[model samples]
Target chain A: MTYWDQEKECMARDNLEKLQLRRLKETVFRSYAFVPAYRAKMDAAGIKPDDVNTLGDLQKLPFTTKQEMRDNYPFGLFAVPMSEVVRIHASSGTTGKPSVVGYTRKDVDTWADLMARALVSAGADKRSVIQVAYGYGLFTGGLGAHYGAERLGASVIPASGGNTQRQILLMQDFGSTHLACTPSYALFIAEVMHDMGIDPAGLKLKAGIFGAEPWSEQMRTEIENKLYIKAYDIYGLSEIMGPGVAIECPFRTGLHIAEDNFLVEIIDPVTEEVLPEGSLGELVITTLTKEAIPMIRYRTRDMTTLSNGECPCGRTHVRMQKVLGRSDDMLIVRGVNVFPSAIETVLLGIPGVEPHYMIILERQDNLDIMEVQVEVSEDIFSDEVRKLEDLHKRIAKELESNLLISVKVRLVEPKSIPRSEGKAVRVKDNRKI
Target chain B: MAKQISVFLENSSGRLAHVTRVLGDAGINIRALSIADTSDFGILRLIVNDPDHAYKILKDAGFTVSETEVIAVRMPDSPGGLADVLDQISEENINIEYLYAFLGFAGGDALVIFKVEDIKKAREVFEKKNINYVEAQDLYKL
Candidate 1:
């Protein structure tokens, strides 16, 4: 229950806001002065560094987006000289170009501290043995957790993802107390553990910090029960920092942002207007203390809400609920908005069905069709065809009821869908658009 | 009690050809084959020369395969010949899950394959009615 930095974590609201305003002014000034991209963006918007005296002036500043990062390409948006930049990480864009992010030495330290705060908020301490299964390199997950665990003075096992059996062997041999990885990988680890005839309760594991992909309460319960550990949600993006932007404390209510380092805002994605607190909208963040690449009002595209309520854990930062889904990931089928995560929540709630699924959207005779290919258990597949068809109809009916859009459901054999060690790709849009 | 190999396949181009290529390369002959398809996927039912070998080869080739028991009845090639057998089975209250036909000769009696809910009951009914059922080895020879 020990705080990593009690003074900064539990700072008074008035003091914290004053600090945020000061950091915001400095960040805006630095971005306008150094980086040409932000400079032009602000200049076009008729904004000056001196104009940002109050925190509300942030809305007047231009917002940086992922497309802007791509247009800038590698190192185009970095504010500092290459010499001062200590490290660089790029997201796996998988489409065109990766969005590169640079970090100075001081920036790295700030990132580690925020991650450390995140780990401690989830109940990890100096004595905790952390197994960082998140993939290292280019991706921020592995290295991010690694630095944070070291900052927390914990013994870190940089497992670096994949090789589940070996991971389990290490988890058992090293008596690891904490796990860091995507929630899907945690379930995979549990699956391998059962195959190895290893009981989860026999392990010294207690808490799991899972993120990097959207997961549901049903999945959290599944991971907790399977691994016999308390699963905590951690949130971050490579564009901002890494795995420590915000995280859920033991209260398990919402993720607490590192308000001192990063300023968070919610905005209507379509209108691009800032929304009131407690309203779900696209997440927008401005790096308050970032030195290498000062992101001025970067649009995160993650849909969520901000609640400034005082947490039972005593942190003064506003808490963001678990992200509902990314606005970019929303699929408009037959003019009806649907999210793959929403379908996942429904599919996971049903019995005899695996959590693996793929949503295929296609155009047929000018009509939009969505097919949900879900993988059921082997037992279900082996059942009578009538029973299998019954399961299929049941899933489709449930989905139509929840999504308000009829969808075709196909029951495929177990393992028919491809599995990923990282974020699961949920949608395949075959429309020419 | 004749064994039939059933494979799950998506209704995509060259999918059935892929399954056939695997079995043909394994030196297994398809004695009789029928495909039941839905809008999305298809089930390829095959009475092969070696059911176990065909199942292994199809499965090893990453196809969803299972061996099922189906009765192959020898019937007259006349129009009512197949109908008579189906009518007798239906009268005995046994449901036919699926059925397919093969030529006994160029223009002679036909070999009809039937997958029923209860293979044992179907056999009892066939025996009581003196319906000639093809054995797995004998059918392979044919």
Candidate 2:
């Protein structure tokens, strides 16, 4: 199950640098010759493929944002003809239009190769029976992990998301060796397994690949303790060819980016000035080897930093810190940028309230107010309106102190809110744009 | 033939007690009661001595209420007593979603409040079996 290019896969800094330059040159020349839009952009920037002879010359290119990608819509930025596209995946459009990405057969193979490498880097091997529970279709998380497990010569059970009972049954029956899904879903699966009186350790899951949404290190430790498995973070975006753009090795230091195929950059989002390495800034990427839709300096809007220091693991690829937060997803509550993850941390720390809650934002009298509706356990309090109001006030005061914003709290009964199998929608913004 | 009245109440606290107090003050006795709640609201099912009067009293007090026909089957309070009634209903292909029960003091009779899919068919089964059913007046005495 070893890679044919094992030496190349673990290339040293000098060798990796040479490999990247060759790939970058090929990609730029291909794009300038084939893609009219890319050629026009390069022409307007007064830059040519021959001009980008060194890595330092990448800044001469223009940056691509999610809004720009969405504005172009489907197949608009394809470097190759539409006939060469083998697959297309899109992001979940919570705010506006979803960003669409197209891939050629070669691009798909490269994606699977990187994903397989990622899994192997995370200790997966041929003996592993990987159970993929990410949502399938349109979204890349499921298929991306699926192909990787297959490529790694592992026994892959593509048990897509939801059907918790059936998922548990398969995990037990098939003795799944690896679990892949969102961190929240992994915890949810563990909860269901406990409720069903099934020991998660007995199911034979040895490791997990959790991604698709950002999770905290506290949550990672909690999940690892509960599932009794080593959890690795796999990062990717559909716009960047799905899951396997980067992955965390066993060192758990940071995700190692496949810089040979993709060049990573950190830029100040407001000023568009590229930041020095190790500086936290918006993550921007450029696909050096992709053919169908070769993105040049695509602004991910995700905040993180790049590290060139050698990892404890012998790999020489650059490392990226876990995504802190999405700039677009940040909520400006009374002039303070608040992320939902921050609220989740404070909420989970509180007693008497379940993790399931909703933050409703409404504008009243030209001022924005947030209402947090938390589900209380049946034993928490008696069924008295006054007692419920008192509990609500307590929760409101606690939230106000933690979030630094006044929040109206409402105590709801258990199972009052709807459950989601994919990304959980916790915030509802009703203010006028 | 016991009378049944449906009481609508908001899911706030002490609402059930308030409704019970109104019936207790009027000197009207409650034979049996069942409550269904969806958290935000609740429907109180009552089998009373006089359902029409109870409904009017609650309605006059600005409470939303209604009256619906529910079977009041009288069975022997011994082994296989309720099973006999259910067996008869099942034999006639009547579906019983839920039911409530109260044992009579004579040690031989019991009253069952049943919410069935087909009320007419259930009543026919009881009538054909010659089962003694309680009337509204009998409930008032209890």
Candidate 3:
């Protein structure tokens, strides 16, 4: 029932926008002065930091794309020197090269504050025992949740990911009350609990914070029912400093962006024009206080609309609808973003596989399943069954390792997949989303 | 050395009929058939007159098809007839992958198709036991 930062969370709309304007000007000035990419973009657009005076003039800045992040690569976009930056994380993608981000010591503190605010908003408190199940290392979900739980004064269990059996055991033994991980993984944990004959009621779990993937409302209901916990959706991207950008309050209508730290805008993805309020379009964000890697109008490509409704929970920041889908052909399978081009790159790297391939996405038991169907060269098909099966397993294993999702690799006959005359259709998403 | 056509099918409505329709349009007559299904997919096995042609046509129609050699054995149309042949094959350590019954002479005798690990070994076992066996060409005519 308590708010982490009540003043900021429930500020008046005018006051909130004023604070945002101040931070926006400072962030733009820093990005333009320190980061060459932002400088070049502003130069091209003939815009200056003072030009972004009111939030209305934010449209004049050029948009930043994912390709620009890739073009900058490792440390090209950092606003601070490496010595001042304390930690780094990167977005997972199919390009083999990731979009790297850095966080200074103060930036890390700000991230923890926002995450704590998110947790407290979702009804987590100091007494709650948090179990972080997101993968650790380069991915931000694990460490992001860990720091927030620590800052909230909760007993943190840094149970990174995998080892579901042990995770269940710890959940019971540690008296874990909060779970932090992807929604699909939460379902998988529930399945493992059922397999182990453990009842959700027997555990002391009270709530769960699930993110790092786009999950449906039906999935949230399933997780809540199976895990006997109030499942809340958390949204973030590595480019925007990972999973605590926005989260659903207890009311659960939509996610409330941490507007004090990041500014949000909805723009027409194609025409590069900002859409009106409450209309669905691609999301763009400008980092307000991030000094390490401040991004100016970074295009998220995630499609969602904005809501300024006053929440019953009293948070006055704008709420964003849960992301519907990407403007591009990025498929999220079991919490991992899989690009058809990434699959194609891996497939083309291996021998005996044709360039032709199809990615089939299906939903089975409220979980996402991705199957890669690739054509096998005639010579490979003519080989013995054992050899062919080995190849199949090999491709599946390789893809699973690279994509971080279990993939079922099917080898079809050569030239069997229907070839299109223009723009090969590589993905067939059968999910009702 | 009888040939059995096996088609992979998704467990959905109209999929089986679609396969049969494709075969029917191609002038391929199915003599005997059975389907083995799981929750996700099914494998349709058929004893057709021309397996190579049927396989080609089914493949061309966008269905996954494969051919396997099966031996046809004539057994008494009564209890323990199948058990007798299975006992013999089991004694010889010849694994029977699958088997199905087919009509023959309307009650005089019944033809049982057996797909085994080793077709030659199965034929030799049937020959040693003096069990009646139908040749592939004669079975096709029937």
Candidate 4:
């Protein structure tokens, strides 16, 4: 019922946009002056700091992508000197090189307040026992939630992650009312509790702030039903002030983006064109007050729809739907942008073709070749060779027309494609470039 | 009503050999076999001693397989044997999708497996035309 920063959270649209304009100008000026990488990019785009006259001028600035962050690497993008920056965090870099980010002392304070605001919105207060279980160390989740809990005057429990049985025991004995963890880990803890024959009703857990991974509403219901606690979806990336970028309030509608700190924009992932409100697209955020890393229009690649409708909870900050998918998987083949999901949609519509497929990209004679390997399932099988060949040709033609790139369709043996445990690797890029 | 076993195989090497090995492991003897192929894939159709068992084993081995009712006609092992059968089938207006030879000459008689559009009509035509076809039990014995 109460907001951590009521004035900023419930500001009028004009006032919020005014504040955003001011912060955007300051952030652009600072990045242009201090960060060489950003200055060059802005200069290349033929834009100056004063070119940003209004909030709408954000579209004119050059977009920053993960590749840009990767290029910057350790301290190349830092706006402040190392001495002024207090803490540093690096992503696990599960794909390539780990991206590192630094936080100035004041940036750290701003992050803590943002996280605190997020926690309070998700029904945590000073009297609550907040268990931060989103991992510690270089991962921003654990310390991010921990510092926020401390700032809220809540009893802090730095449980980190893993050790499911121990997490349950602490929850039971310590009387923790609020939990901050990844949604999957929260379910694991519930499973361990069920196996131990412990009743969730006996514990005092009220809600869980779950993030770091995209989850479905069904999983939220499963966690809520099994753990007997309300589950909230929190979203953030290590590149963008960690776990406090946005969080779902008790209203359970959408995660309210902390617009005061981070300016949010939804853009078409293909054209990189800004989409109108409520249209589903990629989320691009610009860090407004982050002095250590004043990211100017950093493309988050996260796909979500935005809503500017007034929330019943009275938080006037812009709200983003739970992340739908990642545009990071968007592939550019022969000057044509293709989404595997679009191809998948086409695959499902065609009869006799299974939805299971893998997109393989290889460079041939300096041209990008995309080959889709589809399983020859029994449904599409025939004793006549020409029929099966027709099936192959049809699939290839369909993919080519839908993706606007020539595709070679190969039918492999049933269940021959290598499958992974979670989030199956749909695309394999063998290009040496 | 003999049953023909059809297995889908990819163009990748060793896929055909792997399927043969699986059938061999199951001790399923191939009475007759034929392959219809394209550059991308092939459908290996076979008349085996036990078609149901072949279908099960090939499916268990993760190969896409299917079964269709086919008639194996036994005639004298001569130059005109297949021609005579083809003439009779053409007179009956039965469109044969495909046909393949048996593994070996069975007692001076040859067997040819035919996949037709209509099984019941083809079998009825064979009966009226006095064409002697190998029974399902007799094929299993061979």
Candidate 5:
């Protein structure tokens, strides 16, 4: 358990807060002074850099959002000149225009150091061979993990996303010890390995850092069992700092955030007010050390809670639970709020239900109807129609009792659900309204 | 005990066509077929010349196929032929889950497939009542 930066990682809580405050003030002042878009926003809200004397004053600043990023488009909120910006990454922007994020030379270095700390916490060392399977180029996952693994002095194989067979071959031939990719992609890779007849035990893969999509703990167990590796949940977005914002330690406990670099707050998404510690709500982050684009209180839309205590790993940073689901992913069906992850938890516990599912929402008679189409795998399929119907009823019954909402369970053909190379599409809203 | 191939099919178009194409390509002839469908999916019950072969090919083609035991009976080809056969079974208190028509091996007679609640007991009643039913091997040769 050698720390990447033992002094910074294990600093006292009071000292870390002091460091965060200093960086917060500098980031506030720089954003107000260099970026006019942020300055106008602050002026409209009656907030000045000089007024942010304490950390709690962070709530006074207007929150930046994903929609604001797209409105700014490209680089409207960059706090530094283009000469200092050395790297750029944009989210896939499943909606319309991609939200762009820039990294200055110093910001990129800070990102690499933060990612290295995350990797170290998740049990990586200079001797480890890390295979970064995340997509490179405009997507932050690939290059983010690449630089972090390199910073940790570990051997990095830049095996970007999508060549599943070749990735498996390289993972075996290169003696890769760690894999970095989305959890859904990792599951698909495991499926490919099964088809390729490549035994996971025959490979040197040890642990996996999976993020970029919300997944359940049962999903983690499936990946761990399928790949024969420890699956660590990582939390990050390009709006924040890609795949290294926070990650679970080797103990598989809550994810530890680098408090010195990022300030985390859980806020009620509806009221937009910060909640007390350990309350699950939408995550809002204020980057304290980023140089290229100093985001002030960015509403991440991810739902999770923060807990403060000394981790067994000896780090004092606050830990966030594995994200429940994005507020944007929550579906309101028939007046009952439902999280797709809740449906996933139910599906995972039942037999004959594969992890592949698609939630189709429709409006009939001006009422919301949620139909969960579950893939029928070879194991769950039966020639007996009654048996198959019973499985379908079981899923629907369990979902309604568990989620307290009436759900329609549809048994789909085996492998009928479509999966993208990136995040798997879990929901499809077909309501014209 | 006769083997009938039961395949799970989605109600989406072309799936049934695909299954039939796969079985036809394998040189398996459909002797008798019945489809039980819902709004979302269907169960295509098939009585074929080669039940084992049809099941294997459909399974390989990625269709969820299964084999179940059903009784094939040779009844009179009159208007009341089905009623007479079903009346005797009802008299013995045997519950028939479902029954479908099938092509007969010979002319002037009708072949019926019976999926009942109690198959072994049905066989006993059939034997005691002097009913004519095709043997499992004889039915597969149709």
Candidate 6:
């Protein structure tokens, strides 16, 4: 009924810098007293807590990585005691072991507030009925959005992903005003809504907060066009905090990082040297106000840039560009580095193959061969073996032209490939190396 | 010589039409045909009047057409004829993946399309027993 975007932070540069310095000092001191690992790292660098007097000295601190967190495992680096932790969330461990993160009661409240701030930034208010369709449980997206909507004093509908028909039915019956889920699922929901003959524009929904997977601007435009709502991007890693670490304002320029709670830095991915603003590199985050599992200069592996320039929506918190790709997820195919997201963009633009597909890399005779198994739907007319074979050849040729690498194409039945409610696994490398 | 071409197809509506259109354009006449379709992918087995020519056309058109050996057994349309042939193949330890009758009652005999584990052994057994084998010309006529 009513829409009110939250007031954006518009502090002057000098004042914001002073605030960040003060917070950085408190964070270093707290880490020295509570987090022994960080204290040890700082001591090894021959620096004391008092030595980091300014933000410029942050570069002197040792950088943490996902591997480091995994090496510590479970609760090894938790700054607070077990009694202080009220909740836990874990990253989807498709590559290796799952990295676990803990939250104290205050930390949970902080996460809720940040998520609520994200919802408000997307133009939701207390009168809005929010539907959170992200996966619940160990995955943070659902609860992160759930608590955030609740904190906004809105009517929170904890839909929690899957069962498209039911999700749509609730959307219609409950008059849900806000949606929170992965961008892919949001598009799928839009498709379902169209099939059900429910006009998405007529729905009470005003905005959507989509994340959990890297999506393109094309996908954002597609989802917004289909759903008829203003779409926003919410960014966070469970290791740092849940989905509220940063969010896109109405301008959709870049995600404004919660500088008061998290300090963001960009460094050359290969060289590990800190880069000037606007230069794309690996994103490094340091939790400035977290109680449990307080991290110092954690290398996120996410590729993006940080800018302190004021956004049109007026959030002065340092903004990060939309994540281009993940460093670890890049695939080296025939000496050419390829990201699955790039492949996804190409696949979605093609007409024949459905969105569901699998890229399999296998070693054959000391050479890596890429095989793409695409799902064929009713749109494809060929049922005869010869015709199907011809289609496969055509698709392979198209992909070869686009990717600049030869690939074999296999047509599979719809829904044959495995589906995931969380992060979908698109690339499967069977190569021993 | 007649050609036997194997095609890979997914089972769906209008698929047969699309495949027929390609062969029809190439001026190839199907003497006999059979299908081995699962829920996922299907294999279309065809014996064309002009085997070599049809195989080239389909292959050059980017179809994964492979040559396979299939037997053409002539049997009476009555009930015991197919049962007897199956029993004989079973005794010879030859497994039949799929089979279909090519010619109808106009020929007074049914042509059974068959795939066996060992084509040589199955042919030998059929030959030694003097089972009537349908010729390519006779099949085209039917």
Predicted structure with the largest DockQ when compared to the true one: 4
Candidate 3 predicts chain B with a TM-score of 0.93
Residues A1-433, model 6: lDDT tens digits: 1112233256566776788888788878888888777778888989898889889998888998888777778787888889999998899776688899999999998889888888888888889999999988899999999999999999998989899889988888999988999887887788667657789877878788998888777678778888888889989989899898888888888998888788889998788999999998899999887888888898988888888876777667888988877878878889877777767667667665556779999998889899888876545634244456667677887788878898877776555577655567788999997
Please give the TM-score that candidate 3 achieves against the real structure.
0.63
Per-residue error at A147 for model 3, in Å? 0.4
Fraction of real interface contacts that model 3 preserves: 0.00
**Chain B TM-score of candidate number 1:** 0.94
Q: CA lDDT of A287 in candidate 6?
A: 89
User: Can you give the DockQ of every candidate in the order shown?
Assistant: 0.14, 0.02, 0.05, 0.57, 0.36, 0.07
Candidate 5 A-chain TM? 0.97
lDDT of 3 by residue, A1-433 (tens): 5799999999999999999999888988998999998998899989988787799888888888888888899899998889998999987776667999999999899999999999998899999999999888899999999999999999999999889899999999999999998876787788668758899999999999998765566567667888999999999998989889999999999999999999999998779788899998899998898989988889998888999987899999899987766777667787776666567657756765655678999998888988888765443442124445667778898898888889987766445576532124678889766
Off by over 4 Å in 1: B1-142
Candidate 1 overall lDDT versus native: 0.88
How accurate locally is residue B124 in candidate 3, as Cα lDDT from 0 to 100?
89
Chain B TM-score of all predictions, in order? 0.94, 0.86, 0.93, 0.96, 0.96, 0.84
Error at A204, model 2, angstroms: 1.1
Residue B61, candidate 2: alpha-carbon lDDT: 59
Fnat, 2 decimals, each candidate: 0.05, 0.00, 0.00, 0.90, 0.30, 0.10
Task: Kindly state the number of residue pairs that clash in model 2.
Answer: 0
Q: Residue A232 error for model 1, in Å?
A: 1.5
lDDT of 4 at A76: 94
Model 2 per-residue lDDT at A55: 78
Candidate 6 global lDDT:
0.79
TM-score of each: 0.80, 0.71, 0.63, 0.64, 0.89, 0.72
List iRMS (one decimal) for every candidate.
3.2, 11.9, 5.9, 1.0, 2.0, 8.9
Q: Judged by DockQ cut-offs, is candidate 5 incorrect, acceptable, medium or high?
A: acceptable
Task: Give the number of the best model, judged by TM-score.
Answer: 5
Error of 4 at A399 (Å): 1.8
- Which run of 10 residues does model 3 chain A get worst, by summed lDDT? A377-386
- Each model's lDDT: 0.88, 0.79, 0.83, 0.86, 0.88, 0.79
| Residue-by-residue lDDT tens digits, candidate 3, B1-142 | 6988877665568889999999999899988887776454556888888888998898777676778788888888888988888888788899877788774452488888887778888888889988788899988778
Candidate 1 lDDT over A48-116, as tens digits, reads 999999889899998889999999999999999999999999999868999999999998999899899
